[model samples]
Every structure is written in C-alpha cells, then in structure tokens.
Target: MSQVRTKVILYNPKAVFYTMPLALIALASYLDKGIYDVKIIDGRLEKDPLMKILDSCEGAVCFAVSVLTGAPIKDALEMTIEVKKRFPELNIVWGGWHPSLFPLETLKETPVDVVVRGQGEIAFEQILTAIINGQSFQGIAGVSYKDKVTGEIVQNAERNMVDINSFPAFNYDFVPVNSYEKLSGRNQIDYIASQGCRFRCNFCADPFMYKRGWYGYAPTRIADELETLWDKYHFEHVHFQDETFFTIGARVEAIAEEFIKRKFRFSWFGTMRADQGSRLPDEVFAKCKASGLERVMIGLESGSQRMIDWMKKDIKIPQVYESAQKCLKHGIAINFSVIIGFPGETEADMDETIRVVTDLRKMSPEFRVSIFYFKPYPGNEIADALIADGYKMPQGIKEWSDFDYVVKGSPWIPEKKFREIENFKFFQRLAWSKPSLLKTPIQTLAKWRIKNKSYHLPIERKLIELIFDRQKLS
Candidate 1:
C-alpha cells in the first residue's frame, strides 16, 4: 500500500451531550504527529443522509467512540462489530464514560479491541499507532486492551491529565462550514475551557472521571480560539461545554475581556452551579452578558433540601433566590434545570421545586424550567445499586435521560400521576418534543406567571397556569 490513513473517531452529533470537543483535541494531535492519517466526524447535530461513517475511514487501525452521547451505545458497538466483520484488519474500540468503567464487559460483548479507561487522547493515539506500526502496547498509560496472544484485558498505568496547552485550538476543517449552518440554523460550535468538576454529586459521573483535580484551558487561548473560529469558519455561536462556567469566575471574566478585546463575541450558553451564580458579582454578570452570554443554565437538582443533602448537592434555598436576582439583573436569561423523582422524593419536595421555578419566572419573562427525571447513567454512582435492587425499567431506559424519551419513560415516574399536572410525557408525545411546547411557551406564559412579578424569586408557589388552566377549561 502506498499510504494508509487508519484512525477515526465518531461523535454522535445528535446527542444531548455536546462535549465532543475533547475528542477533537485528541484527533488534532494524531493529525499533527503525521504518524497516522486521522479523520473525525461529529454525527451529532449533523443531518448527514447516508451512513458514510464506517466506510469513511478504511483499514482504520482503531476507531474512537464517544459514549457521552448515550444514544449510540448499542448502535456504535454494533457498528464496531460490523466494521470488524467487514474489515478484518481493523480494530474497533470504545471509550468515554460508558466503556471506561465496563472495559472487560464491553470488549467481550462487542467488536471493541480496546477500551481507554481514562482520558483517550494520547493513549488512544499511542495504542493505534503501535497497532499500525506492528509494535507492542504493553506500557501505554490509560489503556485497557486485550493481548492478541493471551486475549486477556490489560489496563496500563493511569494517565495523568492533560495540560490544556498540549493541544491546539479546535480546527474544524474536517467539518464543512456549511454543516454547522445546516444543522443548527446558526453557526453553532461547542468548546470546553475545563476538564473536571470539583464536587462529587452522587447523581453524576464526574466523580469517577476527574477524581479531584481542577483543569482549565488558557484564557487567551480560548479567546483566540473564538476569534479563529469566527475568522476561519464564520461561526456565529458557541455552546461552552464547561461543567461549570462560573466555577472559576475569574477565568470567565478574563474570557469575557478577551472576547470584548477581540470583537469576536457571539451568542453563547453554558451551565453553572447555583452557588456560583449567587456569588457571581453583578459586574462579572454584566461582562458575561455584554460578551454575548445570552443564556445560562443552572443545575438546581432538587427543591428539597433533604434531597440536596442526600445527593451532596450542597445548595441552599437562599442561593437559588439570589442567583435568580443576579441573572435577571444582568439581563442573562436563566434556564433552571430541576431533577425530580430521586429515591427520597416527596410531595413537599416537588411542591418546593414548582415554587422556585415559578418565582424565577416572575423575576423575568425569559426564565424557563427544564425538569428532568432522575437517571442512572451507565457510570453514575447510583447505577450499580439500582441494577442490584432488581428495579426493572422499561426498554426506553436508554433514552430516559433525554427529554424526547420522557413520554415513554414517564410511565415509570408515577403510573397515574403525570397525565394530569406535570405530564411531560403527554407533551413529549403530542408535540414530538417540539421546543414550542416543552419549555418556551409553557414555562413563561402559561406556567410561570402564576405569582405577581417581583424581585423576590418564588420557589414553592404557582408561577404559571398552562396545564391547570387547560384542565379547568376541560
């Protein structure tokens, strides 16, 4: 063969998880080294008609599957098997949260030849190039691989986390500029300024991934990346995938300054904690908004202090209220994310959450509530316990975390309850998960305005009247 390019990574662009830029970081390294020909495709958010993913990279020594998307676990694994069956020379691999914890199970069950139990950027690159060069991968850090001779899984020593500067700014040349426009109706791209979370929320997978170190990209580099995207790709919007944009409020302020300096600011969104929002100064909030941070999502998790205590969320009722005031005053729209139906849920908890959402709405007409059912993602701390408790879930459990799957998954919530008041499933099915019905019109107009408009954020009162009004009419 004259030359062979034998590595690729597939990101399910349609996934609710929009954090594939990390994988892109690793792919960029492979391309720069010139040791292998590498290509990456974000299948998420893309409207690619043909299934050209597997066929795109031939004799691919290895493929990296992004598991955070959660939609493609079964299909991505199946595709790996199919690729292996068709191309006998190729090695299929799986990574990210889904495969990392279940290395042996995933490897044996699927066509996956390798699993990167930790960060994959370097480990995957090293392992793939070795496989291509017909070399040994005995000591590569952060890899779980089956020995060709023994067929036993070998997990190498742990890989230290990456410094942000080790990688280049995201180069989207692999993606057509038109693709972003076509998919989002805006030039939407995602970037991350950080790698790990500080807290150990029982309901999340961060505790398993990051352990306890704080990692972040350089501020100037991030600002530069934004400018580069704007200059090169004509990208007009960004959704920062940072776990908490305000965790390092200073860094966020620096980023805003850079954006203001560069004149490349675009409408952006990111998630932050309630505590961060409350502590965030009005000046910083103003800078964020002026820098085009139009929307900020807060993970309130629960209205019940009991539930918060149990999940170790470390939030206070007052923090929620203060955060609302800060967001509203700064002209930044708030999308409050609430999680209900954890193990210790009661009527009062639900009542309090409804109250908080309603009060936030009165503070500003732009406030919206995004209520989600408690999910035990594959690697979440609760998954093992729940699976052991013999709690049988319906087949739709795969998509239960997704709002679109809420209709089918809702039956598990309260068999007779959701149909009347908080029937997310009804709207999910009737409206086909349309945005018009899910959060926008229903939250601000019909559901949230139940209380008088005021500076005080209400957390346990009727704020809007969408579902109840319809019921009254009926």
Candidate 2:
C-alpha cells in the first residue's frame, strides 16, 4: 500500500493591526523539518482567506486556528465552521490565549475538534504523530478534544512552559518580506525575546496565559537573531514584543552589551511596567539608548493611588513619575498605557489621572499616550468582580469577538463620563504634538486647579479640554 503524508493548515485570523503572526510562524517552523507538512494562511492579508483555506485543506489531516478573546475569535470561528462543512473528516483545532483559558468551554461551544491549551508547539507535534500512527488522542498533554465514538470532550493535562531556545528561528518564507513594519517608513520587525510574565495584575490575562512563569532566550541568542535580521533583511528597528521586556535588568544590560560589541545600529522599543523602569539605574537607560533603545512603553494604569491599590498593581504612583522622568532625561521616548473608567473610580480619580498625564507630557515632548476604556475580559480578577457587580459577560464566541479594548468599555460608565474620556483622549494627542513652554505652565496650573476638586464644574472641565485638546493646534 502507498503511504499517505500528514498535512496541517494553520490560520491566522484578522487582527486590529497587520503584524507578523509569530505564533503561526513558530509552529510552522517546528513542523517544517518534521514528517508533517504545514501551510500558513494569514486572513488579514488574504483576498479571500476562507477560499484559500478550503483550497489548502485538500488532503490535509487537520486545520488549526489560533485566536485571542476579541474580534479575532469571530474570524477564527467563522473560518472553522465553513471548513468543517466542506471537510467534515478533517480535524479542527483551536489554540492561543482564548482557548487556553477556556478549553472545555471552547470545545463545547464551537465546532473545533481539538483545543491545544498551553505551549502549543510540543502538543501540536505530538498530535501530528498520533494521527499519523493511527493511535488514540488520549494521554496527549495540553490538549482538549472530542472523542470520536462517544463525542465527549476530553481535557488533558496542562502543559508546562517551554524553554526559550527550544524552537528554531522563525521561517520568514511563509510571510511576505515587505508586510511587517512598526510604522510607516520604519523598516521594523517585531520579535518575541521571551515568553510569559510573573505579575498577577487583577485585570490582565498574562497570569492565566503563562501561569506566572517567565522565560526568555539568552542575551547573545536574541542579539544574534536581531543582527541576522538587520544584516540579511535590511530591518532597521526591532520591536521587542515581550509582555514586559525589562523583567530582568541584568539580562537587558547583557543584550545591550551584546549589541554594543557587535556595533549594530538599530532603534528598538518594548513594553514594561512602571515599577520595573523605576528599579533600573539611570546608567541602564543611557546604556540602552547608546545601544539604540529609542522608546519604552509603561503601563501607568492609573494616576490615583487608590485606583492603583484597587487594581492590585503593587507599584506606587511615585515610582511611575520617577520612571517617566528617567526615561525623559535619557532621551528615551515614553509611551504611557493609561486606563480610564474603572468600576469604582470617581470624577476626582479621573481628574488626578488627567493631571498626572499632563505633567508627564510636560516632562517629555516625545511622550506617546494611549488611553483605553477598561473592558472586563474573562478569566481575570477584575472581570470576575465586575461580573459579581452585575456586569454582563459575553456568552459565546460570537459575543466574545465583539469585545474590543480600543472602541468599547464597561457599560457602568455613564454616557457623560464616556464622552469626557473621549474628549480627554482627543486633547491628550493634541497636547503631545504641540508642546511648548507656554502650554507647560498652563497645564501645570490646570493640574493644580483640577486637584483642588473643581473638576465637576462645566466651565472648568471645558477650559481644561480646550487648553489641552489637539484640535486647538489645528
């Protein structure tokens, strides 16, 4: 009898932005040199992803789709349903943040045949082996799949975190060479130097996804990868896509030293917690900038200490200011991820946040602020509290897909308050673009005024918005 080869199709559903699908690329690279045949389809760039997937599914053993909790889930589910109709014999799998959090629920709610819970590379490879050998899917770690005969959902043991250097470098052949960039005219590529985070912020899903285990590649390994990309592909910027790039200060210093030794010139940016930056010395920031660290994003969730405590952020408000100042002094651009409309936040709390951000802008003209309305996602401490307080949760994959961090927020926030937040975001952008000596004084004075409990007065609020709003510059 002739031998039949094993084939699997991986799908990257549409996202809010078009970045490299590192997860799919990593999986493809893992399976590429093995017995299994792998193909990747990015829904964001495809003219017709469903048709492309259908065409690719010919003689394929399984179709796997990875997703987040938001709109991407809808995209993945839609693709899975249509693929199932056309090829019912094919195995359908779901992985990534959403499925890893709710494996059984995902298998019960969707048409997916299997759910690969955590660290999918090893589990997925094992799945291919089992299918090829005509063995049972039972005893596979980090997976949930329905039984063929009884059709009962079988949840397997959770998988441990994988070593950082276990996988090979990403195979860029599956994706377009020109498709990835951090910004227009910036030939940048995003790279994940590490996996997992150790923090347990009440509102974050990192704890659930990684189970508080942080792991990263060696400094030399990361630098080697970056230099190879820069030398070979002409990429000038490296966006470190770690959840918190500055988790280990010594490791980062080592990375900077490696880059310095190599004499590589590449501007880079990464996200970090405010406390992490505060713990680092001024020399570290200078060293990083000297080695091409252009920007660092800090999650300054709130300016109010009370709100910070409520969020269980552990970091104090003073630490945030100190970190911002250090970054500004070192000529490193700061991107602040601020959140408004927390469950119990008062108008006074909101005023404090605005005042603090205004001061941050004064410190650095290169400040980039991203303000988001707080949305309660599943499997988070804050989301559970919100649900307990009568907030409605999304029921199915379709409903979950509608949840977006940028455009949508908690329903408990009043329409008036919501409009103010919208207006604040509009003004914050303006203030950053047109910073001057005159505006700094006015902003400081306004901060003092708002701090004194005059925030609720209509005239006072409108005056604050007018002075800071970006539209005024136009």
Candidate 3:
C-alpha cells in the first residue's frame, strides 16, 4: 500500500489582469506528485476564494502564496491571516516578487512562516521536505524563516540562479485554459520561456533579484512542450511573458525555426529590447515572422539620450527607430512603452519624449505607444539611490498595497506638469486610436490639440471620467 501524500496548497492572489498564475504553477509542478499532492487556488477565479481556501486547507501541511509588490499584497495578507487564524499548525509560505525583495520584512507578519527568495523551485522543494520531516530550516538556501522556538527570523544565504531547462515543463492541466481564454477574450496562453534578465536598467528589479543572470529553456524543449500544449489545448496564440525574450538572437532564431518545422498553427508574441531588435539580422526577423510572430513589445523607456544613459538603458535613440522600421517592414504590430516623471527629468526631456512618441505613432496605425509615470520600485539601483538620499519606502504591507506603478503620481512631478502629462496621454490615445462614426470628430479635435499643444479646457475628459466613475460605482 502506498503512503498518504501530504497536501500542499498554493494560492495566487487576485490581480487586475486575467493572466494565469504561472508562478504558482511553477511551484506546484516542481513538487513530486508521489509524495506531495499540490492544489493551486487562484483568487482571481473564485467567487468566494477565502472560503474555498479554508475548505482546501483541511488536511494540507503547507499553504504557500505567490505575491507581487502592489495590491495583491493586500489580498494575500488578508487570506493568509485568516488561514493562520484557523490552521495555526499549518506552515504558511510567502514567495514571489514582494517577498523576494523583502524576505525578512515579510516574516514580521504573523501569518507568513517562511519566505522564499529568487528561483524558488529547488528551495521550495527543500522547504517542503524540511516541513514534512519536522526539520529545521537552518540550512535551506534562498529561504527566510521565523524560528518557532526562539521567535527570531533567520535568513539563509542566497541561492544562485538555476537553468530553467533543468525543471519540469509547465503542466497546463493545473489551470483552466478555457476559463483564462474567456476572461482575456483571446484564445491565447501565457508562457515564460526564460527566467531572470541580463540587462541592468536602474528602474528595474530584475538585476537585484537575479544578480544580472539569465536562463532560458532549450529551443527544442520549448518547441516540444509548446507542440504538446497546442495539441492538448488547441490554443491560437502564445504570449511569451519573459522579460527579455530575445536576449539570445541565435536562440530566438532556433526557437522560430523549431516552431516552423513543427508546422505549428499558432501565432505568438514576445518582449524585445531596442538594441536586441536592431542587432538581429533581416533573415532572423523573416524566420520569426514566418513562424507566427504576430506582435512584439519594446521598452523604449525614454526618448532623451541623456535620460536613457542615466537610466542605464544601454541603447541608442537611433536603435529605437531602427527597430521600429524593421517591425514595420515585417508587418508586425509594435507596442512601445515609455516612462516619464523620472527624477531630474525636465520639460525639455518631456518634449523630446513627446516628439519621439508622436513620430512612432505616425509610423503606422498598428504601432502603439503606452506612457506611464516612473514609480520607484524597490530592489533597483534608482530606488537604492533614493533610499540613500532619504526617500522613504512603504513601511509595511498596508502601505505597499497602495503602490500603483502605472497610475500613481510621482513626488518629483509638479501638479501642473502632471496635468500636462495626463492631458497629453489622453489626447495622444484618442488621436491615434482606430476611429468610428462617433469618435472621428473627437479624434480630429484630439489631433489638433496635440499638434497645437492646447489642453486648456478638457471638458470631454471630465465628462468621460464622470460617466466611467458612475458606471464603476453602479
């Protein structure tokens, strides 16, 4: 007779987007099925997630949550606190971006027993083994735990980054792909072909988390797994969620060739840097296009050369244009994300960004530009510098819950400048958006306002906001 396998429940907190919980899935899939029974509960999909989680925790030995930096922290905390209230003996683990950044800090919370840092597959396995055998977490690398007897936090040495190829392929059966498709309004699957990032942008957290290390699955492995997934799910699209999917040009080329050779019938998208895109040969681009490359997202963080250099973007402004021209030539859609409101940025710098955005918008209607204010996310060079210069970060979970990277206003930006940037964003969206019968006139006026830089009376914006606010409340 087989021994009973202990249940391990993994929870993914509710998020704004419908993207599947790949992180939780990673932890779940890494566990050995013979000894551990892992059940993943995504808060986003449940009507009463807390009740469901409590129901599932009846016989579970461990309750692990994957948390991000912002609003998800609130939900995760609430759920974990409730779980601790009910199942005091169960080991509660917190892992992912927020916990990785603040391992010791996260342990101060009453619920979280252990915090897993970077690349948690191996570490998570060790943690589970230790918990099951009633062993000490003293020697577990990449883990921080509170001593049960002494009540002191112990942070182990950091673990080196591991190659993703060594891990088991993602088990899509763990998630309801059809439900995700319905939620996203696209018959697509989200996948991470690689882990960590090589580039060290000052505003990014990848460098501090991964120590500038990067690893990707072998192209053949990715192709084989994707083919199996396609056959199983019949999805039409694959969205690669890697930070820098095109880091190795030859690897990208090989992946594309595999996709083409397999005769896969799905389109795909990935993230790319301007420097990487510019350096790719024309033939490589052609191969990718032929292999169902539908769209690519490029982070052109700033337009001013000086700002780019200051941020350690390591790419020239000319490379941005070069990449754009290549994408246009290949008939691919491009989404260029730009950041504004950085520390020490001037009006002249904002103007340069606007000029570049306008030029990119004019390139092709298929090209899209997304503008956002720079939020000082921790675990980055800029955030470290700000901390050194006396910038106070959020103290605890409640404070961090209010941190919104996309919509939050930065302290460095004055009110007038903020309004100006907001108006520009509104007009820029309307001016380049696909027009309908009701929006053509508004689009024309928006274009005129953008051209003349005249945003004195934004009555339309106010009215639209009023309508949306009412709808949201209703």
Candidate 4:
C-alpha cells in the first residue's frame, strides 16, 4: 500500500476592504503540523480568486471557506458554486459569522457539504481527521451535514466555546505579509487579543454568536505575540479586532504595563462602549497613551435620549459626553460611531444627532464621527421586529448577501428623507472626515461661529471643490 498526501484549500471571500486574513492563517498553523497540506487564498488580495481555487483543487480533500454577512456571503456562494461545477467530488465546508447563525438555512441554500459553527480550531481538525480516515460524520460536534445515503440534514450538538489563549500563533508564512502593507499604504496590521463580547445590543450579531461570552489571552502572551509581529515584519501600528477591548479592565492595565515595561511603542486602537469608558480611571488612559495607545472607537449610536432608550443601548447621553471628554483630556483620539434611520426614528431625532456631532467636532481635531444607516441583520432583535412589521427578509443567500448597511434597510423611510440623509453624509464628510491643509483654522472659525449663535453663509461646498481640483493638479 502507498501513502496519500492530504491537501486542503482555505479561503477568505471579499470584504469591504483588503485586510490580512488572520483567520485562515491561524487555522493553517494547526492543520499543517505534519498533518495536512494547506493552501490559503485571500480573495481581496487576488486578481482572480476563482481561478486560483480551481488550479489548486488537485486531489484536495476539503474546500473550506469563511464568510461574513452581506456582500461577502454572496461572493463566497458564487465561488462555491463554481468549485462544485469543476470538482463534484470535493467537500465544501462553510464557516464563520453567517453560517453559524443560520446553519440549516445555509446548508439547504448553498452547495456546501458541511457548516462548522462556532470557533473552528478544534472542529476543523476533527473534520480533517474524519476525511482522511474515511469515517462517518455522526460524532462531530458543532457541524450540520447532509447524509450521503439518506440525503437528509443531520446536525450534531453545538460546539462549546474553546479557550483561545491556548491556540497556536498564526503562521504568516502562508501568505506575504508585505502585500497587506502595500495595499493599506501604512505600517499597519490587525491582531486579535480577545474573543466574544459582553453586551446584547439589538443591532449586533456578536451576542448571538458568542452568547455574550468574553475571554482574553494573558497579558504576557499578548506582548510576546506583538513583539514577534514587530521583530519579524516591522509592523508599527496594530488594529485590535476584538468586539470590545475593555471587557475586563484589569487585563487592559496589565497589557498596557507589559508593553510599557518591554519598552515596545507600537501604536494601537480598539473599540469600547460608552458605558464601559465611563468607569475607567484617567490614569489608565494616561498609561496606555504613554505605551502608544492612539485612539478608541466608541459607539455613540444616537444623540437623542429617546432613541437611545428605544435601542436598549443602556447608556446615558451624559455618559457619551463623559467618554469623549476623558479621551480628549488624555490626548487620545476618539472615533464616534453613530447610526440613524432605525425603525421609529424621526426627523427631529436626526437633527439632534447632527447637532450633537457638530458640537463634538469642535472639541478636538482628532475627533471623528462616522454615520451609517441601520441594517436589519439576521438573528438580531430589531430584525425580528422588522419582519413582524411587514418588512420582507431576504429570500436566500444571494438576496441576503446584497444587503447594504450604508443605505436605508427598510422601505418605510420616504425617498425625500433618504436623499436628505445622503446629503447630510456628504456635508459631514467634508467637515470631519477628509484631510485638508485648511482644516485647522477654517474648522476653528466654524466652531466659533456655532458657539456664538452666528449662522454664517455657507461656503464649504465651493471651497471643498476648489481644494479637490488643486489636489488633482498637484
């Protein structure tokens, strides 16, 4: 008898922007330890990802894909359908956010042979073992599959959440790390220090997936990984991809102290809720700043108190102000994540949000406000209400994949109001989002005008056009 080499293909579908595919890299590290031969394909970085997958499908045992909601789902299904057409005998497994929430729905709709729910480190390893030995899929946990003989769906027990602290470090050798830097135009990369979240906001999917479970790796281990990233790749800025970085305050302080003691000055940023921010001491922020903490992204959601209560955000308007003040006082940048066009939002509510953001913009040049139209995502409380109130959910994977969060999610909002929202986004971008040599003095004057109750004639649009043209010339 001769021995056969096991080969597997792992993929990350297209996302809003090109990022280093850490998920694929992490899975490969565990699978490639003299077990299986793994190949990674990041669609965002590839010119033709479909062709790459087709070319690599030579005697492969599994074709695994990770996907998100919205556009990425659509893109993943397209690739899956093509792969099946060419290699009918290969096993296609779907994992990650979308498939985890609706495992049966995904299995019925797409050509996927299996859906690996929850964290994939252990489940994926077992699946590979079964495939290599030609065993039955009866005992696998956290997986939904179709019976080969009966052709019926069989879902096993849900997988328990694993302690990610023990997971091996990502194998960056699978892909070129320098390619990501060229695309981003900076010395930046993303790293995950924690998993899960502690809140159940109605518009989010993290709660449903992790069941509000929060976990973090040890501070010393985090420091070790970050040092490796810097020493090996010269990475300067790290984007932490946790649901909320401050779920545990003591861990944050420990991580900060570890970085400070090691004399590592890698700039970093992460998200925290406004309610969480209100409890942190000023000394923590100062220490973190000294250790290269540059900014914190806080979800303000809405400026109207009534709207805030409606969303069950559980944070007071005064807390929002306090969070912003704390960051500004310590010289840390604040990125305000705002939302409008919820189910019962009014024009008055939108006006109040605009007024609040406009006031916050005057406090510091580093303050940033990003506005997005609400989307009724699957498995969220708001999505259920929207469906009950006569809103039609997407019929299948294709329809759901086309869902856009930037536009109105429901059809209840009038066309006129939708156009008004678009115009407001344009003006907000001109005032707060863009970089301009004329920003400091001009914005300072605009702040003075608003504070003095003097409504000056509008000239920003014309001035922005002139600036754009000058940049084009240069």
Leading candidate by lDDT: 3
lDDT of 4 at 293: 90
**1 against 4, candidate with superior TM-score:** 4
Tens-digit per-residue lDDT, 428-459, candidate 3: 77677666788778778888888988998888
lDDT of 1 at 98: 62
C-alpha lDDT of all candidate models, in order: 0.65, 0.81, 0.90, 0.81
Superposed model 1: Cα runs more than 4 Å off: 1-22, 42-54, 387-417, 420-474
RMSD of each: 6.6, 3.8, 2.6, 3.3
Q: Quote the positional error of residue 457 for candidate 4 in Å.
A: 9.9
For every model shown, the clashing-pair count is: 19, 2, 0, 0
- Native-structure RMSD, model 1: 6.6
Q: Considering every candidate listed, which one attains the maximal TM-score? A: 3
TM-score of each: 0.82, 0.90, 0.96, 0.91
Candidate 4: 10-residue stretch with minimal lDDT: 465-474
Score candidate 4 by TM-score against the native: 0.91
lDDT computed for candidate 3: 0.90
RMSD (CA, angstroms), candidate 2: 3.8
- Looking at model 2, the pairs that clash are 427-469, 430-470
The sequence of per-residue lDDT tens digits that candidate 4 reaches over residues 36-152 is 889998888899999999999878999999988889997899999999999988989988988998899898988898888878888898888887888767779998997777878
